[model samples]
Target: MGLFRSIVGGISNLFNRNNDGLTITKLVDLLNQGYSLLQINSNIYDIPEIRTAINFVAEKIGSVPFYHVRADNEGNMDMINDSFQYVLTVRTNKYQGPQVFWTHVATMYLLNNNAFIMPDWDNRGNLTALYLLPFTQFQFAQEEETGKLIIQFQGNSSYTFYYDDIIHLQRFPTFKGGASKQATGNYITMVNAMENQAVKDSETSGRIAGLLQTKVNLKSSDMKKKLNEFKDTFLTAENVAGLGMIGSEYELLPFNFKDTPLNTEFLNSIIKQLYNYFGVSYEIINNIASELQYEQFVDNTLKPIIYQIEEELTYKLFSKGEISFYNKIQAETVDLEISTLAAKTAFYKEMSYGTIMTRNEIRRRLGMPKGPPELDKFLGNKNFQSLEPGIYEVGGQENNPEDGK
Candidate 1:
């Protein structure tokens, strides 16, 4: 029955035509052909460096909490702190949670240069659930006359979704104006090479460990019998471990194949290149990055991606009025610890004395609880206070111009 169904499905797929009259079979064939064009290739997930790079960025982005805020008529932004925030950051849908969904989306975008989010709307068009689609499974197409975009999920059991109902995130810009696109650049080649090198190294190591060869001198007539006897006696694991041959005629020789040492430096170089390509520093990968460098990594590499996602979410999820009021999503910064208490103290002291940041802002940076409303105001040391137009005092009380008179 299953075989019959599969056959029927295959037949249906062969004849299945999309809105543009392209058969599913032809599309599948084209996709297969495209994949075959690459000499050495692998899934992004299979490559450790690629996986690490993508996950490093994705996990950091996912770990940071997402918040929504709207600007009032007077233009002061306030946090929404509502159900929508929960839906967006905690639980995306019934089947999948937010972190997993976002991680998958980030992985897709990094690998394929595209990601998709589909919102499941309720009766009144309110979003009930958000789902991340497999970007590779879907292709975007446009109507000739109406110019409406369509998403076709290619498989034996296919599904079609409207473009308006889906949120698309594209990494590389498509200035030529095509609906369907491939991933950007030749990073896949690097990933493939790295994977291939690792495989070769593993195979070489296995050969060195387990491979054995023996040379024996025996009469031609007795060769077969002697070989069988040798296999039964010395080749057994127990005999190989403990047995000692008392004959000088038989010799056990280790296989001596001089192999070039694995080019570890070359592998390291490739790893570094992959890390740089993905905007991950070697220090971060090796767990040796300073707090400042880690912060900079987040800012320089991950923040742009966060901002992109925020902008897209804001535009797609919110209404026009909400958007006009500057309602948007934001990813919180991941905090890093100072090297020492002295460093932390000096940092906070400078921040406070220079009035560089408000007390609450300082607390937030230090991963502390927010202080009272008064702490929200930026206040410098009394010694550094400006008094009476241009007069300033380092330590003494302020001298009024009238008092001198």
Candidate 2:
């Protein structure tokens, strides 16, 4: 514990002060011993606070931390923290790679420097000496370029850090303001959502939906635009508003599906048509099939039929109200009606037989047209001629109902 505190204390002191001398140079040299050479802001290393931060990092990492200096005149110092059993070498503009693990660790720890070493902070600040500091956003601004490691900060505000120049972990302010790491809750939520999507795809239709949904092979520019817009909407709205807390002023917010009635209506329509064809209800069919499969089944088979019905429904339905009603069905529902027995036969096996329903039932429920006589004829034929029914005459035409044709 003593050693740990000392390590923290040294780094805090180093970044909190601004001076040029052996202490700062020594800190730089010590960090370099373990890390490979990389470029750093020469001006930054000259600060006393930064030097101290380096020393603290070296002490805590229990490994040599090295820096690369362009000039030979830049003095190198080696320091060993016996309890932690590590050495440190600090330099400038020279190191890069996995060997820089100590550098990254130091940076990660120093991410909280702003909360502790504020400009008007008291020298006797109670929190300054603690190991785990309070949550504060990390800020990253480009300080110097040492290969891929870019030292960035959130704001123009100058704060001392033990290892301010570490890779990837540099502090940068978020667009909404302030610097902060992703919360544990956020991570767990995202992971769980992803797992749920996977499980749903495996058991059902094998497609992605809901939060974090992804579409495959959608390379069109329009699709890309839609995807980017969706991403922006999701990221911008996510938890940043601090909603969902107990006692907060709750608003009747609409869900994603609610805002867009097209998807739901379309789904409802397709499922109904399929249900009619299969002699089942929407709820029964959905209950049996997985969410992922439902969409695919509709897209591949129903969408084209819907398009065809939409093209012809205008002229076919005669009553003014029924015309309007049929139009609504075409606009809102998926059409899976087959024009010929051959087409129906081709898809008979693929079509989900259990719980199939018809478009007319769905349309009537939604106040649409009674649908074409063809729809009824198909339903009648399917019901009577199904393999389960032992292959009866389709329309009293099996034996003598053919009427001497």
Candidate 3:
């Protein structure tokens, strides 16, 4: 435990890309120990569609309210406002608020299909702050003796962590769960290649405008030197562009990339597939989702991720004994229809007849503060007593239509 805490204590060191690497000029030396080199290449995050989808999901789920509710064996549940609650509701860590913290976890989870969050502790092992591990990936294995889960963060050096100390979220896992190391790799490879090709084509025009051909004796080495000089003097110069009078000695052979009809429709089809893989749509992200669309989004997309989060937090934050007592974490789902006053009252009217939720609960759902204790009790519906067929008669006597009265 001491070693784990010490490792997490160096969280700042994990993000320091510079000053940690040895100064090496040679290509082979950069690969040596004590030197860290990051290869520059296009990855999934470079794609705009993926970024939009990820940000949309993270924002929607991360910004919602999470409550720490304790239920007794008799079925009475009460919300508990504790240090953990404060961490979840207000501030999560030294630098990040709850939304930022959750967004970080969600983004990482979407990128890699797994994200780990570590709870910072003080000298007495009390929870001080909560945040995601900055590393891109981690390896997990079981202890030989205790069978407890162990985590080694992949980096220049592995940092060991007990699974008990971290909140591990994995998506699309098989039996062993190791295959998620590059979950996005399978989908993004084709998309990456296509986007890279598109980028190269886009950058083609910027590289060179055209070639200058000579009408004179083509093998004049002196003319070749003069041509290079002219290109360096005129074409490559930044300020001189758009209109230049070329000498009749040269014909402009403008180079243009073939206007190949890239299967843009095909690209979009694949993009849609990617979006569906992450469970996002253009409507929800753009704030144009209809009420039904929003509800469906919540049910199909956000609920699964949020459910996983709740289960993880509940199990990790509470011991087995506490879990038996019904200590749990829950997310307060947001409804799009409740934003308007008319819809709020109409929904409240419907719920009033159902007699399930108390007034305070309804108020809380409607974005209002809690009502007085008197309104916290559930209301009884007199209309619910007519389930019996005989009880539905207008008068005390039964109707005699069958008897032809």
Index of the highest-TM-score prediction: 3
CA displacement after TM-score superposition, residue 132 of candidate 3 (Å)? 0.7
Candidate 3: lDDT over CA atoms?
0.68
Alpha-carbon TM-score of each model against the true structure: 0.64, 0.17, 0.67
Q: Which of the predicted structures, 1 or 3, would earn the higher TM-score when compared with the native?
A: 3
Worst 10 residues of 1 by lDDT: 8-17
Output the worst ten-in-a-row residue range by lDDT, candidate 2. Answer: 113-122
Candidate 2, residue 206: lDDT: 27
**TM-score-based ranking, best first?**
3, 1, 2
Q: lDDT score, residue 32, model 3? A: 41
| Predictions: Cα RMSD each | 10.7, 35.1, 9.9
Candidate 1, residue 288: the lDDT equals: 93
TM-score of 2: 0.17
Off-target runs (Cα >4 Å) in candidate 3 are: 1-42, 123-125, 181-259, 286-293, 334-347, 369-380, 385-405
Off by over 4 Å in 1: 1-42, 72-75, 137-153, 157-162, 176-261, 290-296, 334-351, 354-357, 360-377, 382-386, 389-405
Error of 2 at 295 (Å): 42
